[model samples]
Target chain A: MKNNTKIRKSHGSGGQQSHDLLENVFIPHFRNSYLSDLEDSAVLEGWNGNIAFTTDSYVVDPLQFPGGDIGKLAVSGTINDLAVRGAKPLYLTAGFILEEGLEISVLDNIVRSMAETSKQSGVKIVAGDTKVVSRGSADKLFINTAGIGSVPENLKLGAKYIEPGDEIIINGNIGDHGLAVLLAREDFGLITDIESDVNPLSSLIRKVLDADVKLHAMRDPTRGGLASTLNEIAQLRSVDMYIDEDHIPISDTVESVCQLLGLDPFSIANEGKALFFVAPDDCGRLLQILGSQPLGVHAARIGTVRAGNGQVVLNTRIGGNRLIDMPLGELLPRIC
Target chain B: MKAEIQKIVDEIHTECGEEPIRLMEVCGTHTMAIHRYGLRSMLPSNLQLVSGPGCPVCVTPIHFIDAVLQLATRDDTVICTFGDLIRVPGSSASLESEKMNGHQVRVVYSPVDALRMAIRDKHLHYIFIGVGFETTAPAVAAVIEMARENKVTNFSVACAHKTMPEALKRLAADRQIQIQGLICPGHVSAIIGIQAYEWLAKHHNIACVVSGFDPGDILVSVLMLCRQIKRNECVAGIQYDRVVKAIGNTKALALMHRVFEPCDSEWRGLGMIPASGLAIKSGFRRFDALYRFPVKVKKSPTPSGCICGDILKGIKTPLQCGLFAKECRPDSPIGACMVSSEGTCAAFFKYQVVKSCA
Candidate 1:
């Protein structure tokens, strides 16, 4: 196929056209033996503790934005989901839904992005499928990735382990990805240098795990953001938690955009951030380990857990406290 | 800044000693800010900050939403609205539910964007859901003027725009909630001016402060309100001095006056207030969605057993409502109060519903 060729329904019809499209477009980028075979599924040899599996689909508007796109988001989002659970992600399956009139070059760009992310994260796109819909049936492209990982037998991490006096630590800044995508859409016509913090957390999580700190719980603050993740954990464990508003790292640019748009940074999504609950004694060491990694440079101890009914609070900057309710529906811009 | 806020808070605590004061913040932004900063938790027990009906989405009647839904589902029409209106329940459905059902409902940040869309797609009639107070009405008015100037025949506004003073006058006359003070909306005052709130102070003896949407600003306003109440003074003052002026933005006001006029409007919680809503002027009748695309709208009441009415009146709080967090939640909102992020119930749910640590 030529570089300027547009995708058609026949390309996903599982015929010679499908084979040619896959061979020319995807196989070269994700050229591993398992995927190169073009079999029904990738057969893995025996290895393992408990299996960790997760899946996520990306339908971010604009498809391309500052720092990341839908393709990069798809790969990292799935990988991060597994990593946050103390799992070593090893394999991923990519499924593409291409709108009929989409340009092949656009698909190639996104596929290449996915391949690069997979390579960097030490995960392989071992199995894949593609389906094309008629014009207006779907967006330009949507990528769904399901990841398989191995969790160590001795690793125990969950909300049940969360207790009073435990410290809550988060990696880097919050509200980057959601705001970046929103700004890229140009619906608000506001320009900013903020970029999406969309990257895999496997390396950072691996470092923390290797250090062997007293990890109680871990979560990747994705769609509903840090507030939702914190609230969910608090509810599950029936423990109360409060994070200081002054301590949560937020970029000046991100802060301004959120303020101008009437959005709460705690509730806005972050693609590449994680929350860790650790014993108070191990808090210093965890910070040290997190600071050493490039992705965790801005990591800080945000809050502490307490014994109470399930509630997540924010200690305001001016020596006051308020509850951080779990965000609901979409985070819409306030009109008044 | 934190130190200064503490000083003001301390002053407020000292001035209103043991004197029961019920103050209301008459802006949605103020409602959110008051909760966002946890001011209620910090304030003395003698002072109560109640939420008023300042949220445009919360105050927008259900029949207005039903009419918009009708326009949205029509094949020949496209409905453009702010994001806040998407999830708000109408009589039977919402804009969100209709959008999922494959309707042409779009969320635009400004009215001009909708006008531009209508200009671009001349084949489809675009109806912008003009909801908001004085702060937002000027932009809609300006966009309507732009459409007429450009001769954009396909664009119109289903105007639900409302003025602030009429609602305040109605609230002041209510015998149920004896509100002693008010934190007037800063942005609305920027459009309509501080004089608009003078009636509440002079006629009703309510201490009013046009407040900015900041923790420090709100704290200062609280201090000012406490001072006014202590001195036995009833007057309207401006705490958000930088943005709002005594006369306000005359250009925007002039533009608004040219495109729209005062008309009786229905509010969800507050009921009908005479001349509280803006209707497109007779000259711009061609750009009025109500006149252009007439739809039969059935009378729709507020949801059953929802206390958003009493909540809006400041006679009741969300905790007093039976359906607050149980049947009515932010996820599946049974009333407009829970649906709008700026709604008082939503603010409480998001930042103040939990037990106070103080």
Candidate 2:
């Protein structure tokens, strides 16, 4: 209720303080018909098809980063997860775990960002919960989001439909999200204005789905970037993926940053990007549809699917081939 | 392929006729670049490229890691190190595992960052694990100087830094691998200069060419070495001359000399080489963590069937190691070579190895 007040354990006790905090903060931003009811569950009335559901948690260090923050990232990530499966995202549930000393203003900013993103993506925040813990018990704040989407009965997409002639296309440049967050940490004594490409991909994916192309499979390259996603698909379907190093879109800034840190751009994290496997005949049409959108301006066909043992290969810039293995553990900067 | 690079490759193949030429690249970055770019696939079959004792983490003796682990366990100490060394196994555990046990083990980009932390938190003794070659030693030396100037008594470095020339000499003397040419490290040459490698060429009759980390730079360096071998001229040349000077960076060399001196150091692959390791000077002895916190380090045996030692010495390839991709991998590394990202085994596993258990 007061300006600049820090979070306290009593705020999460479900007492009067909790009521005041929720009424003053979350409700106004996320006010909707289902949420206004204040029921234990928001029973919806429009379920005539298969449902796609996903949940993800945000614990990024430096809660606010270039371009987007944890709140926006959490919403975009879960929505993209469902969208990649060709689902129309409908509703989301947010749960917040606040550290005792986190500032109220910071919490407000994050919540506002989440509400804005969900609204822009045509999704509703229908249910939520909040809890505050003692300092040091958790990082400043952690947000967990669960999303529900409707899958059309006529539309189907999966790795099982992939074949040797399928083509791999990406939405845009890679490594922006990871590099942006790394630079935001400001520990490397390096300066850059690179921003995270964290955005809800439901609209972009919806356009692609409406274009009526032969979409075999789709994956949002989030934590493991495009490399791991492709490898996962390749291994899952027992097909080989051969991507050209030059064709995979990468911004100059991201490329230079990854080079300075001795990191592979393919293995870095991306938030707003998705990979589409399409029939070779419809690859150009898919690219055209993707390129027409602001989010997919840099769309490019990176590689092709091959019938072989499960493997992902990259043709280097110098006309040589190398394997794209799943990145091991933590990505650490090289010593020298 | 670019026509220019293809021309160089053609020249290398032509020059390296029936004779088998073995070239060793002594920098970890070079080792990673070679495999990352698939340069070996571009080279002629007769031309073999082997990795030398390049990776600082791969070449660091396990005893040094054990010593750091002992220091990391102390309540009064906070270990700061490059990210590469955090996962290196000691006799029993790693710094990463120790930190998971609630000890303070921080990954710092530079030694000076640790000094900055020491200045802020005066209560904890920050022991920076100094593990690098000449390319990194100057930065470590500069940080120690800054610590001394700022009068930060709690900051110290556990030095395990190694020099390249001596290790190269040890490799050159070995009769097993028969290394005929060398692709000298680009960054190390920038610090120590082209003159440092002259002896290996002049005395040992081995062709040497300092190279940058780019795929083109490496191929050009290889072509230069092949030309030198064709002419029977054994001397050090520089292909990365834009950054590396003939005499190296004198200011860095002088700063390094002022703060440290050459001492006998233990290398993981090569046995003890005299004057191959850098030790803090007596005047700056107060900043040596080994001097401040004395921890007993009993030598531990290398992992069974890990040919990392032989691999580092150019005596064997990662493919020859029994545990290379089967048991030892980047995810669950059993040897030092598989731990560091720039390590030979790690590079081969990540880039070259195609078959996977899946």
Q: All candidates: CA RMSD in angstroms?
A: 2.9, 2.8
lDDT per residue (tens digit) for residues B9-48 in model 1:
8999899878799999889989988888888878898899
Candidate 1, residue B323: CA error in Å? Answer: 2.4
TM-score: which candidate is best? 2
Off by over 4 Å in 2: A1-4, A332-336, B353-358
lDDT (tens digit, per residue) of candidate 2 on B1-358: 5788788888888888878889999888999888887788788878889988889998899899999999999999999999889888887899999999999999988888899999999999999988999988899999999998889989999998888777777788888868889999999999999776798898889999999988999999999999999899999899998898989999999999998899999898677998899999999999999999998988888889988888888888888888988899887788878889888899998888333311
Tens digits of per-residue lDDT for model 1, A113-138:
99999999999999999999998999
lDDT (Cα, tens digit) per residue for candidate 2, span A173-234: 99998888878875777788789999999999999899889998899888777878888888
The candidate maximizing lDDT is 1
**What level of docking quality does candidate 2 show?**
medium
* Model 1 misplaced stretches (Cα beyond 4 Å): A1-4, A37-40, A45-48, A133-137, A332-336
